[model samples]
Each structure stands twice: as structure tokens, then as C-alpha cells.
Target chain A: MTTVTQEAGAPFGAAPPPADGAGESAIVTEGLTKRFRGGQVAVNALDLAVPRGSVFGFLGPNGSGKTTTIRMLLGLVTPTAGTHSVLGLPATQALPRVGALVEGPAFYPYLSGTANLLRFDAADPTAPRTTARRRVAEALERVGLSAAAGKRYRNYSLGMRQRLAIAAALLGPRELLILDEPTNGLDPQGTREVRALVKEIAADGTTVFVSSHLLAEVEQMCTHAAIMRTGTLVAQGTIASLSGGLATRVRIETPDTADAARVLGTFGLADVRSEAGQVTAELGGHAPERINAALVEEGVAVRGLAVLRPSLEDVFVGLTGEGFDVDG
Target chain B: MSTVDTSTSPGAGSGVRAGEARRTPGLVPVAETLETTERHARPETPTPPVPSARERWAFWRLLGSELGLTFRRPRNLAMLAVIACVPVIIGVTLRIVGGQGGMGGIIADVAGNSLMLTFFALSFLVLLMMPVAVTVVAGDSVAGEAGAGTLRYLLAAPAGRTRLLLVKYLNAAIYAYAVTAVVALSALLTGLVLFPAGPVTLLSGTTITMAEGLLRILIAVGYVGAGMAALAAIGLALSTFTEVSIGAIAGTIVLVIVCQVLRAIPELDSITPYLLPTWFTNFDAVLRAPVDFGALREGLVAFGAYIALFGSIAWARFSGKDITS
Candidate 1:
């Protein structure tokens, strides 16, 4: 079952599979946990697995421990319990194979972007100058900020700074790329550019473990996702599978809204509402096509019949019970 | 499909081998197949690069970066310029005042008069000006990153806290040394250009040759450097406690000023040489004939102790700090 799930359709990109099974799993954690001084758990008993070459989106509300999880993966913060591995090596032992940009990408503001890359290259002994420069140039071009390479970071706009951070992540030729809120301050166009770059990288056989609060971005980019609330993983699965189990909403524009609601009420679907000559019902465990046929045969004038598939946000709300102010 | 061999290649199969080997000769395929099988049998993975001794020297790299930042500013250059002009101004004033008193006599007078002037000028520098410069260079070394929200990024790079603090301290030391060198060189050149190059009379009524006087001046500069180093370390130690650079600068200057005021009392004069700023005027004693190496030696030891004491505190605090805040 695990092997079948791992071999599912490659959503981002397809490269040759790991020849020696080296890339079978880029990141794996078992019962990982962290707690602050006040005994408040920031990350709790997380059991996660990210297959090689997959774009895994870690989604959570603000303060839901996404950053904490990324930090632990990068070995910046030690876990309170359990163990994790990256690129087939233990997380504590695989520092070089992992490249990350956690929080805002902090760099020496006085240094040019090229100079900053040089410093990171210097820090990584395995990364030779020639290779690092080639990677840096390629990454800058990939992010569409090659023109600003010579400029100091202090003069860079927020989006440009974010790109520089991404460029830093790409410097190590790392097997797994971890980014925390990489698109935090970007405009829509900038967000799209980063989204495209992430897809491009993942397609090239690098595992990208991204933690973000943007549900829409996660839905568009991630094939596999995990949702966390207050430090606990509430749901984890493939997007298709998670969405498939959610109840689909059905909206009917009927001449007799009251009569339609009365008929739909017999099906025991929860929270049926009526307004403006329209009846909307949350149908549970029933196909939208079957529900529509039933509504029409009941003699209701169906002016409009539309099925609302549950979005990632709806699944998150349904699982957590509390509606998240997603925009906030 | 020819039965797919699910074997790992020896030496982690060449990145392009799997794609390129398809068209290769028969023997090559046999050998490649064997190599792939060997690679899959090994369970232990390759180890990543660990932070070796050489990599740990990022502390020095950080120090160099800090120095670059310090001199990059035009205001720092202006401060250096002011320090360099002090001796020239004193020489010119003495030359103008003692006309026809013979250039040799004017040189002697200027040398004597300049001591008080140097003391007053350097007092302001030591108590407030120099500390401000040291603070500006060292105080922001780590805390500034925290303020700008760059600390986590730097720390996340796994930069060790001890290495970071050491780099900051070294940068502060460089600023102190440079500031002292400028003041000392300016004083020497101004005295040489404005006053006649000859023997200088000391307060002890003994005359010393120009070479001897210059030698004594060099020793005085060393004392200045040591004194400033102590101030820089103290400022750096204070820097680790706060993210605001201005507060560190202000705190250091305030501490120096309070020490200076307290040391000025006649009763406190006995213990003043033990204080960091007390030795700022130790150069005056060096100017006396039969040079008083006693105070200079005491001042050097006192300054060294301060450096070790304050530097260790900075290192200890930073190494264990919970930098996420």
C-alpha cells in the first residue's frame, strides 16, 4: 500500500526514479515533537514522509508549528522526541544535502547578491567556486532576478530579496530544498513566478518541502500536503484523496425553495439553507449527479444545478471544526 | 522490456550513466550492471561535510566583514580625519605664539603645552567620542541583525555563537587600533612640521634628542591602543545584551564618563591607574625624562585584565544565548 502511494502520478515533474533507491524518501520523521519553556508544544508527535522528487506542502494556520517543523528539519532546532532523515541520511547528519531559507532570508545587507552567494559558497567546503557561481547564476536567472545580481541587498525590493533567499537555497545543489514562507511579501505576479520556479525544480528530481499559510498556493502547487493546527497534524494525504472524502455542496435554484429544502431534509444532509428562490444543501456521502437527479424527479423547477467540490480550505475547516481566517 | 535490473550502481551511478549507457557496447553494459548491483548492497549512506576546523574560522571572516562595514561609511573617515589633525593644530598654535623665541624653544614649549591639550582632546574621545566609535563598530555586530530580523537567518546557517561573538570582538579591536594610530600619527607629524626638529626639554629639566622623543611617543601610542581595546571590549560585552546599537553606544560612553569623573578626585588618584580611562593620560608620564615605565606597565596590565574579563563575558553570554528572540 505504501509503495503504491509512493508511486502515484508525479504531479510536479518526472525524472528517472532513484536508481539505487537513494531518493526513495527525501524526508521522514517519526513522532517528532518540540516544546517551549512554558511547556507549550510548538510541534507535536508529527509522523511525516516526503517521497523523493515530490513537492510536499506543509500547510497550517499562523502559529501552527510549520516554521518549527522546518527548523527541526534543517537541524536549527533539535526535536524533543523522535528522529528525522533527509536525502537518505539522518537529519542531524545530512546538513550539507539540505538547503533552506527559513523565516525571511537574512543576509549581510552591505554585500551584493553575488557576494552573498560567495559567502555561502565559502561556508560550504564541498561547493567549489566554479560550481557555486554556475549554480548562483542559474538560480538567479530561474527566479527572474539575474539583472539585480550586482546590487546590494539593502537596495533590493521585498520580492527581489525573497528571490535572493531562494537563490541562496539553490546554492548548495541540495537534494532537498526547504522553504518557510518563501512568498510571504510577494505580489501576485511574483508569487506566480516563485510557484513556477518551485514546479520547475521539483520536476528536475529535487524534493521541495514547502511550509506556507497560503492555502490557494498550496492547493495549486502541492501534490501531497499535511495540515496542522496548534502544533498537531490534523490531516495528511494526497490532495485528491483528502478532497475525495469531503462532502460536496449542491445548489439548486427552485421555484419552491421551501418544498426543495423539505424534500432534501429527508436525506439527513446537514445545514440545508434557503434564500432568494435557491436551496443549497450540504450533501454527505452522496454523488452530486445522483442528488441532482433526485431533486429534479421530485418536481422542483431546477433553474440552476451546480455541484461545489470541497476546496482545500473547506477540508481544513471541516477537519478542524473552527473556520480559519485564511486571508488573515 | 529487457528485465529491468533494480540494482544500485557502484559509487552512486554517474548522474548521466543511466541515460548514456543504453547505446554502449556489450562489455560495458555487463560491467555497469555489476557496478550497479554492488552499490545497492551497501546500507550505510555517504556522510555530508561536517564543520571542520577550517570552516569554523568563519569567525575571522565575519571579523573581516565587520571591518569592511566600519570603514565603508564616510562618517568614520571624517572621525579619523579629526583625530589626525589634533597634533598639527597644537604645533601651529605654539609656533605662532612663540615668535623669535627660537624654533627649538618653540618646539620645547609646544611639546609641553600639547600634553594638556592632548589630554583634553583625548578625554572627550575616550569618555564619549572613542566609545561611540567603538560602539558603532562593535555594538551592532550581532544585535543589529536581530533588529533587522536577519539574526535568525545567520544563526540558521548554523553559525556558532562563539564564532560570531569572537568576530564582533575582533572588529571592535581593529576600530580601536585604527582610531589610536590615526591620533598618534597626527600628533607626531604636527609636532614635527610646526615645531623645529631638535632636542625637547622634559618636565624633569632634562633634554632628550628627537629620536628619543619619537621613541617615547611610539610607546605612548601603544598605551593608547591598549586603553582603547579595553573600552572596545567593554562596549562589545554590553552589545550582546541589547538589539539597539544606539543604546549600546550610549551605555558604553556613559560608563566611561562616570569612570573618568570619579578617577579625577585626588583621593581616587591612587586607584585611578587601575581604571581603563585612567591610563588615557599615561602618555604624559612617558613624555618625562628618565621615562616612567612604571605607570605605563601598570596601565598595560590593567587594560589586559579588562580585555580578558570583558571578552570572556561576551563570549560566554553569546555562546549560550537563546537567539530566536
Candidate 2:
């Protein structure tokens, strides 16, 4: 279902339907590019498809164009090149159905939390005024900010601000909610709160496309992920697929290491390394059961076997060619 | 690397499998593939139609709220207090200090006619208080949102760029008119109580009845208000260009001062009338017995030109800007 287009460098027009079809995708971008006036390439030829109802993690380092892409998706920034659609509608036409918080939540500091949400919620012309009061209160309650609803936003701590931002996005039941670095600048407790909130949001069957540079953030919250580096998408897929593809090792323990190596060789498993009576191979298409079954059939004493697949961090670092811990 | 409790989390919980080794390593772990209804993902609700009338009503409602917030701010209230004090100062000074001495301007020259004191207050109101009021409200209209990080929400609200800009302009215009009204009404009240109500001498050295004088005062108030509206538009444009509200306000004030200085240059007399501040004082023409519609018309035309020019620039800049801040 990967629809990485060839004309990604071209300007935005009508993008083709996602390979999985439009109804199944929450968001689709083709040839999405942006070149700032100072010759800086903020986003370069990005093609991203987010499936409906999944918590899609947009992973990248700082300055990797995560926020820029979110802006383009929300129609907040006009893309210098390419097009993106949300829920089968052009991004502009799709705005009403989408709820977005970019970078972080920006609200009137002079206004109280509920007041800020009220103003923002009112800006959506589709929201009926009669129900806004209850919706605003419920939103604050869900984010655990109901107690602080009367407090001015300026007085809110970083966590409160982040929660309130999420509440703003949840003022209604949106089909898609785009949050850019939702937990950014929050304390650990705040991060956990926001993470739980995101998890809870996804439970309601809403497609949440959240962006974060922290691998752990995505690892803890995403069902599917895409990694970007220096404004270019490097890898994307279900968490298992992305983790399964790179830097993974399979460890097999047996007394006859040489015979085990010969057997693996016979099985056409290249790059089998033997040490300390154990044979290791890069985990890929080869099934571990087949290895065990062959070793037993060949009369090699198989003591134990294990799959030491690469950690998600290792795959991230390998894909981006930079230390994954870099906060950006 | 993550140790999240799967029961509490939503998407990222499925991990390490048992030793059975039946599932492919590249498959979707234990995480739910999400909802089963992807085929009907698009809701059938027709796209929300943004009716123009609803939009227009929303614009005004937002403007009202914005203005309400401004009126409640200590800084803005203090500015209005100061503007409201001008007529008081003019009335008290003319009553105590000017006694029977004839001052130069139309109202100050009479000194005792309450109708004329309204005219005297505009001398100070038009130059300092009016522009400051406009600057305080308009210069922060767009920039303040960026500074507070609220512009992203407003734009992302899909408050169309042009519509949001229009709303902001109208918000500042409300403040401009409100400030002008505060000054004019205070002056009118001061004129009535602190001095005698009678026929007032016009700038052209002709006497007009008290009713005619009040009518001219109303027109003069509108004239000053129109002038402030022009400055508000300039402030809005400047606000759109910067994230610092202080910078936008200071920039607009500086531009006005520079324009005034430029207009005062004797060698630039040909261009003096074209300057923004030149039209502000044109309300004096309203005090003339034969009312020089020439300068008043010129002043309004200049105001319209300033609003159109600067307002469009704001819309263009704000619409195209990336909300990184």
C-alpha cells in the first residue's frame, strides 16, 4: 500500500488515490515539497499516507519538517510544491473535519482555559453555539483540566498548557486529529498524561497523526510509524514491519556450531556467524521454526534458540544515519 | 525500548511474542489494526457550508469579544481614561486660566461657549490620544496572536486568512470609534456644564446658532474617527509584519512622526497634504461657517486610500505567512 510517487518534486495538483484506496486512508500527500525563500528546503518531496483509525506516528529529528508537514496538512501553510488530501477531500476542503494543533497549542493568555477553548471552538462555524458550553466543559474534563478551567492560560504550567491544547483539538469528535509534538516541553508526568490522552483518543476510533522526534514517544504511542531525516522521509510502515527490516539478529544455540553453520549454509542463510557454540544470522524472511526443525532433523543437539531482533531505536538510528537520541 | 503498560496505552502495546515462532516477524504484532469500518471512513454529512451571513455574524461577534477584552485591560482602560481626561483638562484650563483672554482656535477663542469647548478638545485628541488609542488596539491585532502563539489556532481554525484579517481590522475599528466617542462625548458634556451654551463663533468669523454648532460638533467627531480608522489600518498592516506588538505599535507611531516631520519640511509643501497626519487636523474645516468641504473631502479620500492600501498589504502578508511562531 506504499504510494511513493515518482513526481514528488513537482508542484501540487490532483494526487492519485492511495494504493489502499481513498476510503481506507486518513491522509495522503503526493510530491509534497516546500522551498522557503532563503533557499532552505524545509520539506523535500514527501509522500505520506496515514490509514484511517490508526494512531500514525510521524517521526523525525528536529528540523526534519514534521511541523511544516503538519502545517501543510492543515492548510495553514501553502506548499511550495505538491498536494495533500485528508479523508478523500483536498486539504483545504477537508479542514472542517480535521482538528489540528501545530508545534504546540497557542491560545490567548489573558483568557481562561475554558474561555480559550470556547473562542477556538466557536471559530469552527459548524459547531452549534447551543452545545458549545457543554462541549467545552467536557473537553476540559477529558483532558483533566476541568478543575483549571477557570484559571487563565498564562498561569498554566507547561503540562496544563499541553493538555488544554489537546482539549482544544477534542472540542468535537473529529475524524482526524493532527497534533505536532503534543508532549513537547512537558515534564515527565505531563508527557505521560498527554500520552494517555492520545491513547484514549485513539481508543475512540479517531485517526491521530501525531509527530514527535523522540523514538520512545512513538514507540510508546504509535501503531504505525514513518521516520524522516533532514526533511526527507527515510522509512515508513507498521511498527513491526519497520522494526523487522533492519539491524535484527537471530541467535541459535547448539553444541555443534560448525555443523549448525553448515546446516544454515545448506539452508542458503548467508552471513551466518558462529561463536561460542552458537550460530547467529540476520533475521529476515527466514523463519526460526524452520531453523529449529532442520537442526533437529540433522541430528545437531539444539540446546536453545532465541530471536534478538534489533530494538526500534537501533532501526531508527540505522535508517536516519544519526543517533536516534538526538532530541531534534 | 518502551515499557508502556499495554492496557493503558492504545496503539503501541503489541510487542515480543511467545517462543511458538508461528507469526512472521514482519507482521503486525498484537496491536489492533484499528477500527474495522475503514471502507466507510468518509462520513456522509455534507461538507459544512460556511454561509456568508453566518461568517459575517461570527466576524462581528469575535470583534465584540476582542473589543470587550481590550476594554477590560488595565493598559487600554488607562489609555481611554487619559483620552477622556483631555476635555476635562481643556474645560478646566479654559475656565480657570484663559478667563476672558481670546485663544487662537475657534472654541478656545470664545472660551466661555460650551459648544466651542468640544472643538477645543479635538486639538489634542486628534494629534496624540486618537492615534495612541488606534495604535494600542490595532498594532497588536495580528502580532499579539503570534507572540502568544495563538495565530496558529486561529488560522488552523480555518478562519480564512482574508476573513480573519477583516475581523481584526473591524476589531480595531471598533476601538478607534469607541475611543473617539469617549473623547467627543466627554468634551460635549464638559462644554455644556463648565461653560455657557449659546451661539458659537465659527472659524470663518461668522456666528452660528447653538443647534448648528452641535451638528458641526458631531460631524467633527466623525471626521476624527475616520482619521483614527486610517491609522488603525496602518497599525494592522504593521502588526501583520512582526511578532512583537511593541514593535508594530512603535513602528506605526514612528512612521506617523516621520510622516509629520516630512510634511513639515517647507521644501516638501507640495507633498504635505498627502501625508497621513495632514488629514487629521482637517476637522477644523468643519468648524468653518461655510464648511470647506474641500479639505474634509480630501481628508476622507486620503483615509480611504490609506485603509485600502495598508489593509490589502496586511491581508496579503498574513495570508502568505507561515505560522512557525
- Each candidate's number of clashing pairs is 2, 4
Deviation of model 1 at B196, angstroms:
1.8
- Assess the local accuracy of residue A159 in candidate 2 as a C-alpha lDDT between 0 and 100: 85
TM-score, first chain, each model: 0.84, 0.79
Pairs clashing within candidate 2: A11-A82, A12-A82, A61-A328, A62-A328
Candidate 2 off by > 4 Å: A1-21, A247-307, B1-56, B100-110
DockQ of 1: 0.10
RMSD of each: 8.3, 12.4
- Model 1 per-residue lDDT at B267: 86
DockQ of 2: 0.17
Docking quality class, candidate 2: incorrect
lDDT of 2 by residue, A127-238 (tens): 5466779989999999999899999999998889888988888886577899998989998888898898889889987899999888888988999999988888888889
Model 1, range B181-228, lDDT digits (tens) per residue? 776666666655554567766767788876777677667667777788
Per-prediction TM-score of chain B? Answer: 0.75, 0.80
lDDT for each candidate structure: 0.71, 0.79
